[model samples]
Target: MEYVTLGKTGLKISRMGFGGIPIQRIDADGTKKLMKMLVEKGLNYIDTARGYTVSESFIGEGIEGMRDRFVLATKSMSRTKEAMAKDIDISLENLRTDYIDLYQVHNPNMEQLLTVIGEGGALEALKEAKEAGKIGHIGITVHSLEVFEKALEMDWVETIMFPYNIVERQGEELIHKCSEKNIGFIDMKPLAGGAIEDGRLALRFVCANPDVTVVIPGMYDVSEIEKNMEAVEDVSELTAEELEAMEKVRKQLGTNFCRRCNYCQPCTVGINISGCFLFQGYLDRYGLEDWAKDRYGAMAVKAGACVECGACETRCPYNLPIRQMLKKCAEEFGA
Candidate 1:
């Protein structure tokens, strides 16, 4: 695997990192197996988050003996100094490590961003943790273009994680700025939250960008790691067939599609918002009608359960017309 220094942090890591979100679906033993595989494959960067239930603890169990082999990074949703400080200690204990390589202020809106950097905010705790040798560096993860641009101006932001894939290139210009400013650009949602059906093409598209320091695609199985590694290691130019395929994906999945960040949670009627969109994508794009319908049918709360409440839309950083989209899903699923 090709390795590069993560901008500003001065820590060397593989260009292809392991995203820890999917670990929620697997057990600690399973995560351990994947970590072993990662070591064998020469991948040294692992990104997880405090909000990802059991992710930190699972990783702690997974990398028990070989913690030194990887650079650990994680984030939290806490915005206050007390919350962030408490979270840092919790992360350290859960990861079974004394220090974390990078701890990020997870996705925050413009208002929350100001609150985090304001007096007695999360930034204060982050700096304290850094001085206390609990965290090696600090960064920010963002979903909005406004927050992404704002993070660039902060001197404390050593790295930035944002979505950048074939279907979502809204951050291209700012991503270039990340490289110019010597900040590590971590590419998330390389497959557009499973919207793009072609994994190889999705990875190839993200890796082609020179400004991205590393691309972290969520993986839970060994086969996934292998497939992603192949795409990341292929340094050849994009073939005409690949370019054409990418265009097809762009046309099929426009920017209005959901990235499945799940920021739009707690549906007023308790509907699984992202699950609806995911199955809908399968039904519409992947030709998995039977499978999609079965999964959609299994959900206790269906898309039709939406109460037309705009609560989810307001919380959505992407400002997606979620109610309308859910209505379409209700019609599609006939529920």
Candidate 2:
């Protein structure tokens, strides 16, 4: 229940904000229930994105009458002024609020970032929206270290969202820079996309970082919310046992594992890149051979279907050799 002012924006939000991606798996009513519980527990920050497939709408429906109780934030992938302007309106309507506390430019690579800040770019629309009182602050979400570094220098950026977990500490230095620059540093993928089995350990590792203004772990149910809240609210220093557990997690996950951000999608051949990696990890690392095989079998497009177009690798923030990895998966699964 600890609260902090989001850098630059001065938005006072709970250290543990609600990530809205998982709500896509549930209905609007389910989201509404979670929203009610969030209010009761005093967890008031909610992060969603227009690309998260119904996430914004569900949140809008969930927070219907209780809009003022939350600091709402969302992002869009639109790189153009027209598209961003349109997305801002859509987000406002979907979130059931005319004024969004924060609107962000979704993950854009170096080229797209330049285009977005250039003439007729999304930044124009975001600034216009701020002037129009549609949004309170502007920010950017990035995956690669290059973009993270570049975003740090942008005067328009009030906040930055990046993946920071026990295994994904590559942004540690830049995250510190965020605090130095007075730009809110929002931590995403605090659980390393569910790679770290211990939720409490994952949360503790993130909450311990003073540079992180907020950590949004996607929640869909009451038990998860309560459990995550307990982990976040415990401000005590990390116990020796917890530190040992975190190291163990880093060792097991290594640096090559997937975080399942789903930035690599629409596989030229329609392969579920992240899903394939998920099942493969379970098959290879967790000894869930049968379960993994079953899930891999169910996929409409298997890893063997990858034609090596390399389109996905270009989008991957980690620059994962997805095609080669898929080849390994295909060999292991015998697809």
- Residue 224's lDDT in candidate 2: 99
Clashes of 2: 0
* lDDT tens digits by residue: candidate 1, 69-151: 99999999999999999999999999999999999999999999999999989999999999999999999999989999999
- Those runs of model 1 whose alpha carbons end farther than 4 Å from true positions after fitting are none
**Model 2: residues >4 Å from true position, as ranges?**
none
Give the Å shift of residue 84 in candidate 2. Answer: 0.9
Model 1 residue-pair collision total: 0
TM-score of each: 0.98, 0.97
For each candidate, the alpha-carbon lDDT, in order, equals: 0.95, 0.94
Tens digits of per-residue lDDT for model 2, 49-108: 999999999999989889999999999999999999999999999888999999999999
Displacement of residue 302 (Cα, Å) in model 1 is 1.3
